[model samples]
Target: MSLPITKSRFCISYSISKFSRFFPNPSSLSSFYSQSPSVDVHDSQPPSDDVQDFVSQFHSMFHMRPVPPINQFQKILGSLAKMKHYSTTISLFKQMELKGIQSNLVILSIIINCLCELGQMRCSFSVLAKILRLGYHPDVIALNTLMRGLCRNSDVKKALTFHDKAVAQGFRFNEVTYGILINGLCKGGETEAAIKLLRIVEGGLCKCNVVMYSPIIDSLFKDNLAKEAYDLVTKMISNKIMPDACIYNIMIHALCKERRIKEAKNVLAVMVKTYVKPTCVTLNILMDWYSLVNEMKSAEHIFNTMTQLKVTPTIISYNIMISGLLKNKRVDEAMNIFQEMPKRNMVPDRVTYNILLDGLCKSGRISNVWDLIDEMHYRNQQPNVITYTCVIHAFCKNYHLDKAFELFKIMMKKGIQPSMHTWNIFIDGMCKGGRLQEAQKIFQYLLIKGYPLNVFCYSTMINGLCKEGLIDEALTLWSKMEDNGCLPDTVTFEIMIRALFEKDEIDKAETFLREMILRGLMT
Candidate 1:
């Protein structure tokens, strides 16, 4: 289903090479506009109030008795670009040219950036050629924008070739230039290429810095090359390129992911000792990890330390604490934190509500769940699929199967499609509650509806059949699971084998156990 990396890169490069040849001439901006497809306003959402106001102001400025200076036009264009009204920006640029307004490098570069953002690479290249035709030497920013456009198109190889040509034309680039190229390489899964480029640029005109090294390091960690990433950091230190908060955060996050808490702590210590202040993100990462491993005391300490360090805790910070406490069954503590959020001027988002609601549901505090859901509505945070799923799960857990089914129908009526997990929870509930026939009906319905059933879904049904003394039916479902291409996992095999052994089918149990081992599903 996936192309080989080499073939994928070659395809991208080849496609880019083909498009590179069709660049419109730069002498006439009108010709360039003619070649490009006109931006259809109907295709995009209507502009916001602020954007509308800006457009009115732009028109007034444009039709003035004495037009504003080029810098004034540039400012308006830059602001529009920042607002992500790329099409509008390009249209306004055309207006300026038609009015015979002399264009500067800054204005041209802005147009190039807008084109790049709009994915009009051919138009972007045409703008670059215009910059050259007007005897304006493209600065590092202009060339960087062009290369970034190439990279954004997934033509990193073409970007490299462009970089080589720029160097040949005697144009000097800066650290930002290399940063874009390195980032592109890493994003394209060319970490080794990024490192090699970093080596080539080190101690040269554009000395390599954290900006250049961070992406490669992060990519290395993602590829599970922890030692290589660590060594790269050491090399950066030796070269006096001190790691900043961003760099330290990357290291801490990666180490925490690997469950290397001690190493993560050491990195934090080094970060602090070196006077690199830990950010809110750094503290949040530690808090999340501690909470996950049930080290609530450590999580609490980090939460408190945020204020001491003058790092303002964000809504995310509160959400993490609440989720963590609730996960560890500290429902009351979570509720306390949730209540305290308003005092801190933080409005709880949907995720906050879902976490607390699910906790309350699991804790059998069903009485207060409706009140919280009403509060969500009052706050304009309407319950979505996850919210409905939580309530249904709670009802099912409390043996209120009728209420669960009722809520499921209400969810469907409200156009909230049930997720696979929702179906799984409901089916598992029915099976455990001795409603095997209902579970089978729902399972069959899911299959008929073409749901991409996973091993867990099939295994759940098979387990239910076996428990209901339908061994032949369970065996049939097991065969159907494999034929459907949902291969049995270790859990599925263990469930089947255990069910068979309990039913005194020792021969079938041993046969399944041997097959599971042979398939490497079990050790």
Candidate 2:
């Protein structure tokens, strides 16, 4: 055998008398057993073949011991991440550091990955500082891991900071890294910043094209910058960055918002004419667009076309159709669609109830509204704040103040504290019932209880008092309300005029009307 093998066999048999000036003999790992407690490193342990196999497999993965193997460290970090057990993972990384294994890029990458997974971007960045301070150069994978993870978790500020660091460290910020950062900026509603990042990256170091332009277009649409969004679409196609369904859908939404239905449809037609098959999101956006423009026929046509295409309508699709039917007063058909949701294995969510309830209430179908309440209870779907408020508003409108108060009380007792809308409904009921004093009492109570008094609430009470011949009280409250930041409107001035007229004080009424005119009212 080789001299190394001869040395290994001799080393296993007896202690060496001196250092050998010979071949590098691999250490006899079997001698490790005698130096310490015996270890059943092999699968010869019959009781636990599985555990023995695991141990053997682990040792076989990497041969070095002092450098606690990279895979085990990485696997531990991964499991912790998957479990979302961040604190424990952090502690383990600290332990690895204490063992002086000199965390490799892989170990550093995994730790940063875990930090980003937890959305602990601040912590991830702190680890980056540690990596740099240790004078250990991080590779592209390590830098990208931190960059991509931080951006994905919405820690865009730190992600960008790390991006600058990567560039400073001579790591190329490739398309994947830049794209992720742009996506994060758009999602965070920093459209200007996203555009700036895109501009900074156009030095031919990177080949950014139309794919980069989509998010900027989408962001413009999201911020209601429709004109800007429209301009970008033309710019994109001219630049040869072909518009996909997403880009087209975003434009369609913006155009529909502006009531430019024809232009929006042309975009959709372009999408359909191309290989870009209309997706559910596209169809839903179109349906919403048509509904918003009150082009009911177009909306219905799209719905029928979607069904003919063999693409099953999602819950959102069904809800939009039901809302359209109800808006057109096709109550029975709307109810049928609502009832048929479960047969397709789709259960109604909060939006479904909200659409139905709003429709019924708007149509003054209070009896149907009550039926929905019962249905909600039967289906174990507890009425939310909006549901309770809508029903109460309906009751208040019909002068059924007693029923409204009962439901409002029950809603409060159920820990669904009355929202501002709920309070506004009750105030309206009090106003209609000529219970101005009671309304004022509740107003003061709501203010004292720290429930914010919206302008609507303040206006309602001011009008109620002015109409009740409580002009002096109304005037004082109006001044105090303004001092408390409640804005007075044209109706508020009109009510003040009426209150002055109630006292047959024509001089003050005309004087105040002139002041309102100076304030850009009564024009």
Candidate 3:
């Protein structure tokens, strides 16, 4: 039976467990000794006496002297692996090696499976080689574990290579093996190949299992190949295999991505009819999709329906609502949702603050946004790049250049580099303020930094000079703008025409107007 952990004891134990390996001295000596006559490499390996004391300690801790049976040891290792006791795994593997237990197929597969599951793929492959070197048959499970790792790392070709080799070695494909292959092929958009593989499995001597079909359907969904996914679902049912929640969720997500809301709802209905329950991931897909399409009301409805169906929304679900409301310009509603978050027992993350700031900034309420920022700081929430950028752009729009610059400096201090958008805002503001010389310095800085001055920047400077009645200067800058590889916008043409006319240069004005008409910039 598992013992209950109190809060204080848990905290103490957690810290104590962090240094768990100080007791397990694997290497006796630590410091490298070059002058100590490079210890003669032994042709024969050292004896196990070095680890005998720790081996006995392991036995004492468990109150067992004899090693457990293969299955029993497997169960214990599985539990340890699940607990992510990496040190324990390393220790056990080492002890097993020392005992000459021989890393056979079963043991190697189990350890490799655990390592692969933990994203330690390198170690898994090392064990694979060790098993092979030991002259033992590397089982299908071991090969499958490696394939799963390769697939996870998006190394599809490598996985396929292993699959071919395994199949050649009389390894019949299992659900996991096919699932990994189908997932990789679907993700890689090798749909034709995936279909071909399916045909091969169908025609080959190996019988098609119910397990392989789910991932193929799920992969079809992943690729937004909804029709294929739907057909596969039908095939699963006709095969007398029960469609699981995973298959249903995948189809629902596919329908959502395709913006087939009605069909998505239909899929959900079928899921319910089949007595398959929707998990949090299923509801999240719906809510997130609805949010993406700006259908906040529908998103909220689905969220409510999810709760009614006993599906608890994770923090991600709430974030979707907040984000959708903000993007739809329902700032007040977004804030209301944020304010009432504590009522639902949810804490505000950086995303929550940034979303609120974004809505406020876009609506031209920088003062309130500043207040919100202060409140966030008061609440011990730090501003991130999104928050800083939003506030800086807001300042630039309100001609609060000083404040915007301050935030830019603060962002740099926080190790958050200002993006091109941030630079554009300041440049636009500077041009508008008749600070062309300062703007020119910034322009050059941007150019040297490899950031091209976008069309807006070019037009803004030209328009600024034109408004100042500096026709010659504006024309010169316009030519320099073109030389810098900045394309002239429609606004740039209009500004040039206006500048020429203001200077009473009638001929030049007519010439500029002709260019504008020739470019089809204005009707």
Q: Each model's C-alpha lDDT?
A: 0.84, 0.71, 0.69
Q: Candidate 2 on 304-374: residue-level lDDT in tens? A: 78878766789998898888888888877888989999998988877799889988887788888777888
Write one digit per residue (lDDT tens) for candidate 3, span 84-196.
Answer: 55445445655555554444467667777766666666556667666666788776677887888877877666676665555555666565676667667666666666565
- Cand. 1 Cα-lDDT: 0.84
Better of 1 and 2 by TM-score: 1
Cα lDDT of model 1 by residue, 1-523, tens digit: 2111222211212233344354565455457666443333631346788777766777788688788888988888888888888887777777667668888999899989888877777788888888888899988888898888888899787787676566657887888988998899898888887787777677364687899989989999999998999899999989999899989999999999989987998999999999999999999999999898889999999998899998999888998999999888999999999999999889999999999999999889988887998999899898999999999899888888988999899889989999999999899889878899999999999999999988888888988888888989999999999999999999888888998999899999999999999998877
Relative to the unseen true structure, what is the C-alpha lDDT of residue 362 in candidate 3, on a scale of 0 to 100?
Answer: 85
Clash count per candidate:
0, 0, 0
lDDT of 3 at 511: 89
User: Which one wins by lDDT: 2 or 3?
Assistant: 2
Arrange candidates by lDDT, highest first: which order? 1, 2, 3
Give lDDT for model 2.
0.71
Q: Least accurate stretch of 10 residues (summed lDDT) in model 2?
A: 1-10
**Which residue runs of candidate 1 sit more than 4 Å off their true CA positions?**
1-19, 22-49, 84-88, 91-104, 118-122, 133-135, 374-385, 413-416, 466-476, 487-523
Error of 3 at 67 (Å): 11
